[model samples]
Each structure stands twice: as C-alpha cells, then as structure tokens.
Target: MTSFEELGLSAATLKAIAELGYEEPTPIQARTIRRMLDGADVIAQAQTGTGKTAAFALPIIERLDTRSHHPQALVLTPTRELAVQVAEAFQAYGKYHQIAILPVYGGQPIERQLRALSRGVQVVVGTPGRLLDHIRRGTLALDQVRTVVLDEADEMLDMGFIEDIEAILQETPSERQTALFSATMPQPIVDLARRYLRDPERIIVQTEQMTVPQIRQVYYEVGGRDKFEVLARVLDYESPSSAIIFCRTKSEVDALGQRLTARAFPAETLHGDMTQVQRDRVMARFRSGQAELLVATDVAARGLDVEHVSHVINYDIPLDPEIYVHRIGRTGRAGRSGTAITLVTPRERRLLKLIERSTGAPIQRLRVPTIADVIARRRESFKETLRETIAAGGLEPYVSIAEDLGEEYSPTDLAAAAFKLLLGEPPEDAEDLLAEQEPDTTEEEGGRRPRRRREQSFGPERGMTRLYLDVGRNDGVRPADIVGAIANEANIPGRAVGAIELFEHFSFVEVPSNLAERVVRALKRTTIRGRPIAPSLARPRRATGGARSGERR
Candidate 1:
C-alpha cells in the first residue's frame, strides 16, 4: 500500500508514474524498488503478473546516469518476447530521464541494432545468447553496466543458457549490483545467483495483501478459434452497460475489433500503433456512450478510466499474473461490482494454476454463454426499454394505429408483433455455446508446439526442410514459443512448421525447404530458450538418411 511518491524516487520518475496513472505501488514493486534503490542485490520470488517488471524497471530507471551512453544496466531475459517486453518497460519508466533503453535479441536485423548501439543507449535488454553474440562481435559495449538483472532465471537455466548467462555476467563490472527475479528458483538458478549476485537481499512479495473483493474472476476453457463466437455470446448474455476486451497482440486487437464490428457490436480497437488522434477518437466514442465495447492491448488499455465498465473480458490471458491483476482491475472500479472472465486453452491450465497460487484466489470455471442465454438477455433488455418508453409517455399519436392493428389481432398476437418490431424475433436457439468449445489441443498434439499450433496455418504444395536449433524440449521450450516467434516476427504461418523433434541439446523442424535459410537467419537474430540461436545444419537429412539406407543394404 506504499505510495510511489513516498518511495524516494526522483521527481522525474514520480512524475512519469503519475502520468502513467499509477499512484500506488503493488507489493512487489514497493518492496523490490526500495531494496534495489538501497544498492542491495536482491532475489525476488514472485509470479509473472505481480508487476515485477515495474518493480525492477522503475529502480533501474531512477538510478540510470543519463549523460553517459555506455550501458548502465543489462537485463538478460529468457526469450525475445520477454526481452522486448522488458525493454519496453524501461522506456516507459525512464521517459522522464530522457534515457534510451534498447532491446537486442535474435530475429531482428543486427545491422540496424548495431547502428543504434554505436549511437549509444543507456540500457541494454537482451536474451543472453544474443547479448553474448554482440559482446563477441564487438557490437555491444557494456564496460559501464552497473546493474544486471536475470529475469525468469529458472527458465533460462532450463533452456541451457546458464553458461551463456555466466559469461555475459563476467563481461560486466564485478562491482555491479545484480537482481534476480524468478517464479521458481531451481538449483541451477540458485547456483547462478550464488555465483553472480553479491550478498543479495531476499524479498518475497506475497499476493496475500490484495484481493479482488468487488470483482468476480471466472474463465471459460475453450479453443482459440472458438473464442470469437464465445466472446460474442458472452457479450450478448452479459449485456454490460459497457465493457473492454483485452487482447495480447496488436494484430489480435485489430482482428477482434473487425470481427466484433462485423457482428454489429459497437466496438473499437486501440493499440500502440494507432496515432494519438485515432486513439483519442476511440476513447471519445467509448466514453461518450457511442461505443459499447473497447478492444485493446495492454499498452493501450493502461489507465483507462471508464467508470461504467461492468466487465473486463481477457479475450486472451495475459502472459503474466500481474498483468491479469491490471486487466481485471480495469473493471470492478469506483466502488462498483464487476466481472472478469478469462478464456483459457487447456495447456494454459498450469499457467492458471500459477496465477491462482500467486493471487491466493481460485478462479471459478464458467460455462460458455448459451445461445438461449443470449436471446433471454436481449428479451430482458427490450423489456427494460419498453418500460422506460412507457414511463416517458410520448406515443399518443401512435395509440390509434396500434388500436387499428388490435382490431385485426388479439392482444397476445398484437403484443408479439410489437415485440418483434421493437427487438426483432426472439432467437429460439437452444444449443450451448460450450458444445462447440474445444480445448486448445495444440499442447497435446503429438507434433505441434503450443503457441504456434492454431494461431496460424500454412497451406500445402510445400516440401519440408529440416533445420537445427541450439536448444530443445529439455529447456521447457514449447512449440508456442517457436511458433509465436516465427509467425508474429518472421511472417511464417504457424502451420508451416511440420514435424518437430526436441533433443537434449538441440531441436529441428520441417519448414518449407525454401524458407529454411530465412527461418534460420530470423531465429538466429532472436532468443529462444534465453540465448542467441546457434542454428546450423547438424546433418543434412538426405545425407544422413541416405547413408543409413546404404549401410543397411
């Protein structure tokens, strides 16, 4: 419950936090920021959605030396996705410092990043493997890096990045302050901390302090493809005075907005890519009651103050638990009761468990809104409208016309006709929306990885190319990390990935043969399993398999 202004941050940082609309620090933010500011190397055990990014990021930003271009801090993340997110946090928190925060990872154009590096940035956030690559290539200079953060350290160790991470740490100043944050500290992570972090202060930010007292947290387990229909059904059934739908990526926000528009919901999309003017217009519509639903990404949805919002639908579950708190916190505000429903794929069940454990609140499972439910909601809404209209008493001129119709029809028939005219025919659908719901089977699919499974598809008329990956299934690497990385960043269809095999040290996938080089080159530029991709041909399938066949003959 500590106020951010009372945390001894610089006036500039406090101003930025206020501008970002955060008046108080979450428990993790409050405890970690104070400890880190005191120059104590710290180990924090907290879940993802617990505002850990800002917990670490704000302290780093507050301490950064703006005049020097040399790296003052290096944050090593386990995945390119996380690297980007962390770097973004630095930029947001350090806005008042006029400091530069750069995200360098595999999959991005190295030359462009190198040019930026030469120009100078204050902080470098990277996957360990890519950071090591830059250190070796002389593209990055970290002689002044005073602070090092190993985020999601356990996942990094699982992915075989311990050696790479240790090497990166060695390159930084020995006098540096290091902070480590992880959900679970396995032996390797603990060992890494012991060797690198100097007399670290331990902080455990329990979720016990906070509760969503006015919010009803629920979820409907369903497949990704059926989410839109289910979302529509939920909207029709809930009939909130106003609502917001949270999406993970900008593309999702845009696509869902389009889909909702097509289905005739008064909705609009907002994301980082939109111009300020466009963002303004969307907010204007939502606030002025012209739009009923606001579909947005986390960045765009931050600090939204629409008080009438009765529900927040996480169209996609956030990557971390703190983000879940933030998303649902959008509703149940201003002393009003609110509802939050997350749509979960079965594979994310573990993630949900983690969230529940961290928050100490069990999320109730919800049945998908039925088609009959949608109709009932609409009928009720019309009834309310009818009551309001009668109260206003402005239909004197139309009374005789109704009477003329009443001559041809009985009271019941006339009333039914009037109901049809006003609210359309009541949809008599009896099917449960849950009937079509499919648990996201990607995680269980024998071949496809989770993130990449259903988000996209590649068509036929393609031959498969087998390529090597430096890390494998042993690293807790799922198909989704690979697929999400490829599809979103490489423009590769998620389905384009064919057979995959995860070995202890490496992995391989069958992609379109022609796209092999592109995939390898792209993957090399980003981190998967927390390090630079060391993609190289271990053995050509033709040569290895052909040689084996000849030996057998």
Candidate 2:
C-alpha cells in the first residue's frame, strides 16, 4: 500500500516516477530508498524485475548535488548491457535535475568514455573491468565519489570479476556510502560485504511463489534448425499483441530478429553489441507497438520493465533455472494473465527438467503448431473481423460488389473464394505443411526416410523451377545447407525446396515456380559457407543420361 509520496521522495523524483507510470513503490524500493537517501550503506537481496534499479537510482538522483561536476555516484554492473540499463534508469529518474550520467563499459570505444569523463559526469555506471581500466588509465577519479553501488554482486562474482571489483573499490573514498545488491547471499558475497560495507542495512524482498499462477507455462520440443518455422506457426496461432522472445546469445537474437522481420513480423532486437543510441531506438520501437516482437538476450533485457507483453518466449532455453524464471516473469505482471512458452531441443530436455525441478512449476508440453492450426486460427480471426465490420454497418460498397459477383457464382462459392483470397493460396504440396510438423520419433530412431529422387535429365519436378548458384562442392555446400539457406532466407517451408544438385563449381536448386523470384532475391542477401552467392534462374539444358552422383532429393 506504500506509495512514492509516503516514501518521502522529492516532488521532482515523484513527478518522474509518476510520468513513468509507477504508482506505488515495490517492496525493495520502499525499504531501500529511504536508507539510501539517509546515506546509509545497504545490502539488499533482490532479483531482477523487482524494481531494484529504481530502489537505488531514485535515491542516488535525489541525493546528488547538481552543482558538482565530478562523479558523486558510481554503479558497477556485471555486464555492459546492465551498465547501460542502469545508466538509463538514472537518467530517467534524474531527468528534472541537471545531472550528467555516463555508462562506461567494454565493447564500446574507450575514447567515448574518456570524452564523457573529460566532460565531467556526476554519475558513472560501468562494468568492473571497464571501470578498472579507466582507473588504471588515470582517466577516472573516484576519490570524491559519495556513493558506490555494486549491482548484481553475485553475478559479478560468478563471472570471476571479484578481483576487478576489489581493485576498483580500493580507488574509491573509504568514507563513501556503499550498497551491495545480490539475489543470493553466497559466502563470497557475504565476505566481500563484511570487508567493505559498515553495518549495512540488510533488506530482503521476498519474491512471489515460483509457480507463477497467473502465467500459463508451456513448452514445445523442437529441432534446433526448425525453431524458426515452429515459432512462425506458434505466432500465427497465438496472435499475441506483444511478445518478447529471449535468445541465449547476441548472434541468436540478431539472427532471429532478421528471420522474424523477413517473415513479415514487426520485430526489433536488443543485444549487448548495440550502441546506446541503437538500443534506445529499438526499445522505442518496441514500446510504441511499432514492433510487436522484441528479440533479446538475457543481459540486454536486464532492467526492462514493459508491462504489456502478452507472451514471453524462450527461443533458446536458459541454462540456469533462475534465469528461466526471470525471463518468463517479464510477462504475467500486475495480476494479468500471460503465456510463457519455451522451445526445447532434444539435447536441452535435461536442462528443461532441471528448471522444472528448481522452480517447482510443471511446464505443460505442447506440440509445435501445424500449418492447419495456423490456417484455422487465421480463419477464425478473419471471421471475427468480418463480424465486427458487419456490426459497424460499412459494407454497402462491398455488398454491391458481392451482388455483382453473385450473378456469376453462388453466394457460398463467392464467400469461399473470398476466404481463399484472404488466406492466400494453400501450399502446392502437403509436404510443405508436413515439413514443419514435429517429428514423431528422433532421427536416431530412423524417423526420416530417404528422399525420393527425380532424374536431373527430366528437369525440376512439376510446378518447380530450377535456380543456379555459383558455388557448390568446391564451396563445401551440402544438400542440407542449400535447404536451410533457401528455407530460412526466403521464409519458406523446407519441403518447398526440391532436389539440389551439387556440381564441382556450381549448384542447382529447385523451388516452386511461384516462389522462384523471391528465392533469388532472398539468396542475394545471404551467403553460403562464408561465400557470397549469385542465384539466377537456370537455363534449360539437354537431357542427361541419369542423376549425377552428388545429386540429392
């Protein structure tokens, strides 16, 4: 029931919090802010997504002296992403005050940090290594720092940055207020706190039950390569208004973002490699609903507090059980129902089991949505739109057109044709749908049958056209490689790709005639075996004696 007003925050701080739509203080914020403002060293045990950033940031901003140009507060985070996030939070909370904040971290040019430091920032949020580097380079002075916060202390210890942390702290004023926040009180963290903090106020925020009753947790078992296709199907079936898809690595986030965009999903990516401006733009797009999906790594998503996310998808299952909980907790907020989905590959099932055991919440298993399911969902959505449109009474023009069309066809036939047009043409072959289906058995169990071959002399199979690429066996290209490239780049079903023929210096692939041009365009934007490829429609050739040795169906 505690509000920011009752917490004794200044009007400016309260205004910023109100603008940010925070009506009440979270338990951690309520307990820690006052202690921090009173210049007390505090050690708070809290997890991510519990408003911990605001707990420290609000006090830091309120207590800062705008007249001083030197850094008064130093926040050390475990990762560059967290540093940026924390720095941004400080900026947001301190917007009304004329305080300069700089986030110094690795992966960014040190020259930028040097320039900012030279300009005299009042607050510096940085990773331990980068902060230590600045200290060693004589570009940063923490002698006058009034407050120092070690954020995610356990994470820093786990990442083996304890020495860097110790070295950085030694450069700071011994009289400075020090606060250490960690999710768990590991012995090392306890020892570090005892070594530095002087009778710090220990505050623990008890997290909600791990069952996350408001969240409907489920997972799909899928192959690593087919994850994208399965995700597309799931997105169509779920039709989530907003979603965050978590990947394990920056590369995975980038790749998945591109794939989702290529498939016509409005998606943005957040990762550690992105610059601050780029990260800001991405977050802007996502928060404004211009982008429906945000593909991100765990580190980059730290301190993200969007409340409207309808779903949280683990594109790659987290290796740690606590991380799994943190990822899904982004959704199902404020007592609102949400869905949490995870995609588990065969080898990752053991890790998934560990998460279930750790959280004491059983994630229901789901079959990867089928093409039929996607189509059915689309039809239902279309019908809803139709009903709403009819209820709105704006169908006169369309009704006139339908009447004219009725002269040529029955009403039911006309409706069917219109629905077909809305849904687009069905896949030419049922194989296209089957390709996305979850395998009933593992490959080791011989779930797959040998592909049937059509002689190269006969050219591509019916309704298929052949395309040529400039690289082949010489480029170490394999059939699977070709299929993966075309299917992923073009956002087409794998079965839509026909036979692939690998010659010494070139290769030929068959795709649906309808999709030939699109495949060519997509291939132009992709590379194979680290070599760029120029794909074009293949010219007719004389009948060959038989299938070539390297040909694969």
lDDT of 2 by residue, 1-553 (tens): 8889987889988866554435578789999999998999999998765678888999999888899889999999998767866787787688788799999988888988889999899999999888888898999999989999999999999999998999988999999999999989999999999999998999998876455445899998766555666686688789888899998667778767754653346778998789999999989878888788899887788889998999999988764455677789899887788999998766566567757765778999987666566667878898999999889997787888998988999999998898877655655554654554343324222244322111111234778888777677878888899999999999999988888878656678889988887998899899999987767656444221122345555
User: Which TM-score value belongs to model 1?
Assistant: 0.54
Model 2 quality (TM-score): 0.49
> lDDT (CA) for every model shown?
0.74, 0.79
* TM-scores for candidates 1 onward, in order: 0.54, 0.49
Which portions of model 2 miss their true places by more than 4 Å?
210-553
Question: Where does candidate 2 have its weakest 10-residue lDDT segment?
Answer: 449-458
Name the runs in model 1 displaced over 4 angstroms.
Answer: 204-210, 213-238, 242-309, 313-338, 341-357, 360-553
